[model samples]
Target: MTQHTPHLWSRLRYRFDILMAHGTPVLIGWLTAVCLAIVVPASVVLVGASRDVPTTAAGWGAAVWRSVGQTLRLGGEVGSPVYVMMSVLLALVALLFVSALVSLITTGLHHRLLALRSGRSPVLEERHTVLLGWTDQVFPVITELVAANADRRRATVAVFADRDKVGMETEITSRVGGTGATRVVCRSGSTTDPTLLSVVSPHTAKAVLVLPPEDPGGDAHVVKTLLALRATGPETRDCVVVAAVRDARNHPAAALAAGPHGHVLSVDDVVARLLVQTSRQPGLSLVHQELLDFAGDEFYVVPVPALTGRTFGEALGAFATSSVVGLRRDGGGMVLNPPSDTRVGPADRFVVITEDDGTAVLADTPPAVDEDAIVTARPRTQAAERLLLLGWNRRAPLIVEQLASYVPSGSTLDVVTLADAAAVRGACRPGRLDVRFLRGDTTDRGRLAELDVPSYDRVLVIGDRGHAVGPDAEPERAADDRTLVTLLHLRDIEQSAGRELFVITEMTDDRNRLLAPVREGADFIVSDRLVSLLMTQISENRHLAALYDELFAAEGSEVHLKPAADYVVTDRPVSFATVVESARRRHECAIGYRLHAGAATGPAHGVRINPDKREPVRFGDRDTVIVIAED
Candidate 1:
């Protein structure tokens, strides 16, 4: 119904328009050349005309006839061929110069096209490792990595995060700059993408440590990354992929995702077990540091000589430089502070502490027993300990598994939940742990009071990952609030009962830890933050494990609170230096001490571990000695 008007420009003109839009510089160059050509020719012609040189053939014909006539009078036409040859040579030289310039532009485009085909962009060439997560623990992790990699050939680390990469880079550089490092590089890309992952070559990488995404229900990203790598096929199978997970329930899926050689670690059980070790014996992390690190000294599991058969106590001092800690018997069994009577057979291997196994100091002489000391240090009996678990999450099951090894028979666990969900993670059972489920609001004072809280020895506040708590809320904040509220109610109970409670809870926020008060014994496990910190430290200084062992060993070497009555008189205020001098005599490292005033009710009347010697040991009618013991 309408009459169509034709387009002012045709299809070819539209195509030209698009090309001109993109090649404005080229278009400008061509136009400039055309303008110069026209201007030069017109100016020369006009100037010549002004000087009375004709512009047409008629003038040329007249000029030729006149030149002939003039030649007769003078002489000039004979050398005109020379002028023509000179002009041709000059024109050829000009053409060659212009060709070279055009070649330069074409060559630039060729190189760019080649780069596109090959799939790479030229970038910074500094020797900096890259990190790819945004987290509170990132600063510490970078700090430790800087220290670990200080001896690298170059400086600088690159970080790619979910947040602005440049922003993360700037903030980290400003905050952790002073920690010895070369530099930090940042770029934006989702770490899960293979195209993005290629920016940091997994094949030629020094190391790759993946952290759990900030809000993933505990290491979901870590698991996904592992699966991504595994699915990448066999080429990258050998690459070392270290990932930290929060829940053991996800371990199987994570393991399946990790494939054959990758290492998937559950931070929950690892930290929980470590805290539990530190609780029973504080300073466990230090011992692990000593053993895990390459510097100072470390623990190595070495197979013994075929002829080496000696009792455990007798072989304690066998190694010239290494100190024997325990034996890893058979394949799966281990005896950490075995009885002196326990024999180290020819097939048995020893877990000994040394600077390095490559330069091992094997004992040349036969070892003998220090029977009296070993016998005196043997545990009197396996005492029953109480454990209380509040809330639920992925790590709940692993805690139950590791507890079986440390908690003695008859031990009890009271698991308190909201709506009191009754569910256990895969391949798990509470019966083995003597765990009893008490469905109630743990934070409620009356309800918490009704449960006989004072009877429990240890309270573990786990974060709830239930339906009431949205999956998107900050896990750490949610867990922390629950812990604070529960602690308040526990404090009230303790106020009336005048009984000390030992509480160890998980913390998501390292900064928010000061908000809660633990009138009873309490320790917070900031597992995720520390995992990255330890990884970076180990990456740079491989020798840190030696320090770890000295702090975490359960038997023989442990932080303990014993009766000072055995080592020092209570009425005296002995200086810490003097006590250290005394304890060092027995091969123990003295760090700090606890007071006996809190422990006098039971067999352990009052005992503080690593006490300051100057503190009056007024042997409270109820105190004992707190110390580290290398049994």
Candidate 2:
């Protein structure tokens, strides 16, 4: 019997465990049962034992009601000592029951509040921009988006990332200060989770941007995020999804996941092309920056009925405040720097570079063209150049390939890095560029002297990605640190050689670009910031993706900085209109120019885009005109 009693006790404990597992409802039920057991027994004892209590049914009911009042802490009149004693015992049991009940309710409410604040709730926003994943790129993207939304009545940007909600908001607030009329909302979650992606309401968003993370597996996570968004709903397919990946190999998968309406960009391709292009032209990056950022002059497609039958060359002088770079056909094809005879249809729109939309207003009459100031001499013939590349990373091979496509044949490229020479040799397929690799540290002054840095026509420095990517932030800082050190060495070498080096430094962080020791007229390309700017531009208008594709392609009309002498006479002051007209004769479009004297100045960096055409500007012997032309 004793053993059976133990067994029975165990079974009873198991049943209690099951009951407790039922959560708040079951706990509340137990408390109610306890209250009843306390109140009913006390009432029965009071009705039967106390002589002051009546034995009638009505009396019993009154006693039970009094006991219930005592259990609930509501005072009731006591008739006798027995009744008073029963009431006191009921009060003690009631105290225990009330404490347990309050604790259970408090705990449940706390859990509910926590769940609500976990950023798991769905956003109730429509037509808002949704950005997934967090990186250094978020700040620039948010800033650009805010600028893009400046003219809107109301705008919202929802950011979803696997980070703390409050932290993201704080960082954005500090970095992108004062987003006027634009509301930025942040939610915390993983981009690869379908539920998390839905939390930002990507289906109803005006556009969705997927920012690749900073780790080695960032591209993989981006691919997963695209898949997750597709799994969210069918409506997401119709949404304008813009995604970017670090590796070009993952571009096809990302694009396929983004659907036909979506746009996919490769960071390596964009940055590599820009680096290769900017290495030749010093101030071209600043001009590209102005075109890419929203705070300054940018590309806008505006229809003008007045220029319906005008030729593409005549359209250059149609806008006084804007510079016409290209024309968009009715069939959605863009022809940048088209021939002088190319006519604009009634339905075609002009692609003008202006400060803002609607600001590309037409001029009543074209500005006076100084035909005598126009220089008709042909552009100087190209010559083979010697180039040197410092440091090596994942993008090094792409940069080399881009250089091969742009540089003339017989041009030699010497790559100096701490990495193995044979590995880089195997990766490079330099078609036109004569490639040479040397195993040495680029930061070492002795090795750089041996290579004769000043002997090269231009020097390109790329940050090492081997140490720039990892779970830790120190690696990225370390990579930037190495690049800065290399720049310092180059600066010292230039000082010793008494000759300026046309240095184009690739920086991982935008903040570190300011800390580099490069001399005046040097170019710094913050790779991630450029990627963010491109993503923001595409998010605002999907059609711009095709425009950018053509602009950045190797065999197209790209933005170039040619000698001002090639367009107009460099000996006298001339209006920008004259330069435009001169470029029109050569089948090119003149947008702006760079002053060799003010190249070291603040703000504009001597690069002016979309300047006042009627204002007469004097060009120095070394001044260059910014134009869109095919090589």
Candidate 3:
């Protein structure tokens, strides 16, 4: 009997499992039907057992109706004990059935809601920006997009990743605060999965950004995601796609995967180049940030038929507010800071620096040139520099290579790191630079003091990349902490010696940049944040890639912040048009000026770009003029 009972219960449990396997709606409906079946029959039996009910069929039907009414507390009265008992029994049975049914239905509905919150449902947005993959780079990209779309009536950015949708939303909200008019939506799914990619409605998207993951296998994941995006139908495949690749070796493969309409930015190479450039020029990073970010003056390409016959040099003075930088050829090519004699072709588009596209208009009359204030004498030659590079990372080698091109012959570069010196030497090419390496921990004050920090003309602090204890550990945080410690020591040593030292530090995250000790004269290169801004900018304007490439490369005309005294007399009020004329006399383009007294302050730190050309401004002897010239 016991064995038979176990078998019977097992069969019943199997049948119940099958019934529950049907989805939420079906399960709720089945529960409702089961409750009704039990309640109705039980009510009929109770009526038959009642004393006041008759035995005939008509009497039985009437009694059953009365029993149901009594169970529902609608028709019957509490008369005799037997009648009362029968009513109470039927009422209890109905209560039990209703309680079970409500519980089942509520449970089913809750589970269904949970499934929906998992981001499995498809989006119905059009002309939106779609972001694929999740990493530390996502927040900066979203923030930049929000600022870029601030003027729009409505803008939507949809994010897809293999993470919890609710969690992603919460983290982004906590980090970014209010998104203004831009709506940011997050979905949970693998970026490489085609079935899941459809949920973001790629066909309706206007642009797509693919961010590399934080793991070591980031390149593989990015390639797969790009491939998946390309596999989407022709409608989505034609949309503009921008991706970031960490390794330069993967550029060819990623570019191939991205096809003709896509732009692949090598993050390591870009950051390395920026670091080397900023090391020489203290405020160069801020200039790059202003050009890339939407909150400041950004690069804009617009067709100006009025200046079709003017020379590129003549067109520079045509804009009252916008600063003309270059021209875009008609057949989809870009030239930044072209030769002065280059004529503006009929089909060419002017690349001007302006607050917005609508404000990039040409002035009716060019500002008057001040020939007396212009200086035609060339600046003195650059002497050999004593450079000290502290710490090491993947970008260290590239920094050395780029630095070699800028530094003069007989310049000495000292690289100090805990890493093997031989390996560092092998990676660098011996140009005119006298390169040497020392193995030591940079965070130690004693070790730093031994290097004599104040003696070097420039100091660069590189964040450690090997601080992570495991594959999933947070390494950037630890590396930044170490960098902060090293900066504190360097600042103390410099203050004790009472001398000025130009310092440039590389940071992994933007939030930590504010926490560094030496904030005033120091420059910070937030690798990921800059990359994120560049990716977003290129995704919006593809021609910008070529413009920035020329700006960062060593062979072209680059932006430089020269002494204000080099252009005009100090403390004398002079119009910006006079400064422009002075720059032109020296075969250069003057964009703006920096106030030395206010260089350490907030906001723009006295770095003004694209000022009104007709306004007269007084410049101090120590102030610097922002210009573009061949060095």
Candidate 4:
């Protein structure tokens, strides 16, 4: 029995340790047990020592109750010195145990609060938006989401990224300002970790937007994040997921990782295409901004039962406030700028551009068309022209490709960049354009003068990313400042030549656009802002994915700024209904017209979209009409 005593004590000690490790509640239970052990035995001893203790069970219970009061220091009966000294000792023991219990509860509560602030707790929200990853695009995306939720009573946007939870919240609050009625919750952790990604509860979210990081390997990380999101559960498969890739090569991989219901886009391709289109056509950026942002007019797919069996041409003037841009066939295909005589099926939906979903109401009667004011003049034939490109970056090659596909054969393009001439030539192979590269600094006035800036039909200044910066410096600002200096030199040259140049400047930040030199017929393309707008739009409505895909592609119908004279008599005051009718005759849809007088003005910048059809206006020879057409 003595030999086994040590083994038995060891086992009991192990069990006691296990019990104590159960946290505050277990410690409290043990404290109560210890208190009862001392109090009850002391009560029995005091009752037995009492001089006049009764022999009955009731008298013995009364005596023990008096001892309990003494132990708690509530009161004490007149007893001998031995009982009094023992009661004092019990009170001291009670004080020690009670103090430990309070301390445990306080420390436990503090630890739980810290855990919550660390973004380790799971979010319990339904139908919220989940944003993964972080970039400069988060500001605009969050701002637009707030605007999108203006009609709802309550909405939430939960953010999960590998950043400080408090820091993320502070930056968003500073940049986005007040988000009334919309709760923004941020979680910090590595997005690639599946365990961390589950904290935001992506399964219950209505939509998930994966923002591409600014690093070189952002696309790979985005793909991993998408796979991680999928690994969360099958419920996330039904939620709308959208992402963008910086390189075209990663688009297929990203789409596959995003699953069947997810949508992925190539940001480089979209920005490249916009650079090519906007360089030739000024004020087009304003039109795109109107369509992309939620604060202004946007595209909506609405079911128009009134025009189910009507022709596409007849539906152009059906809405007095909205413009019909395309049709979504009931079977599944999208036909944009289709033939005027194309019939709308019963289940087909009209793709209209309007301010709100309920504002696409059909008119009681078709607006009066000014037949006499309509012109039958043909559009000008394509002519070979000289084009000049300033600056260079990773997107330069894609921009060259898009320009080559759109320009006529034999058109000459001269590139003045700081990049290696041989490398530029190797990447930018000509399709229909005669591409030339000149190694020069675009910001130098003497270098820009050597190119004969006024001789080119259009000038493009792309943001350069080759500038060196410190580890703590902002990379985009250095490039944007360089672009601004180049623009200032170009504006000076234009002043000396007495001719306004159609300059298209590419900027990385939307705030820097306001700092760029103001020039007539000039436009700025904030690449990050546009991509954020696209992702937000798709997340809100998944059907727009295909619509925008068709709109941005080279082989499909695209937005064009054509001469207003091609559609209607430019000198006469005619209603917008007349322009719509004239465009329908030429197998096109006229959304709005740009006025040359207002081109340099504030606010609209000469661009008007989805205007009232009954308002009459006169156009000049230089004025252009915004339309969706197939070239």
Residue pairs with backbone overlap in model 4 = none
Candidate order, TM-score descending: 3, 4, 2, 1
Across 1-631, the per-residue lDDT of candidate 2 in tens digits comes to: 3553458889999999999999998899998899888878877887678768675886787677676776567455566768867876777687889999999999999997777667777899999999999999999999999999999989999999988887888899999999999999989888888977888999999999999888878888998998898889884444688999988878988888877788999988888999988987889889888899998899988898988998888888877889999888999888788888889999998888998878999887778889899987565778999999988887888899999988888999988876766678888894878999877887788888899889999999988645222223335567799898888988899999999998998877899988888765578888888999999998987778988988888889998998888788878889999999998888889999999898888678798999988989999879999999997
Candidate 1 residue-wise lDDT, 449-531, digit = tens: 78888888777776665534223334567767876788788778877899877666666766655677653234566676557
Per-residue lDDT of 39-104 in model 3, one digit per residue for the tens? 679988887677776869867766766666665553453467688678767776877788899999
Ranking by lDDT: 4, 2, 3, 1
Top candidate (lDDT)? 4
Candidate lDDT values, in order: 0.57, 0.86, 0.83, 0.86
The positional error of residue 511 in candidate 2, measured at the CA in angstroms, is: 1.4
- Pick out the ten consecutive residues of candidate 4 with the lowest summed lDDT: 467-476
What's each prediction's clash count? 60, 0, 0, 0
Q: Is candidate 1 or candidate 4 better by TM-score?
A: 4
Residue 531 of candidate 3: its Cα lDDT? 88
Q: What TM-score, over all chains together, does every model reach?
A: 0.57, 0.83, 0.84, 0.84
User: After TM-score superposition, what is the CA distance of residue 369 in candidate 3 from its true location, in Å?
Assistant: 3.0
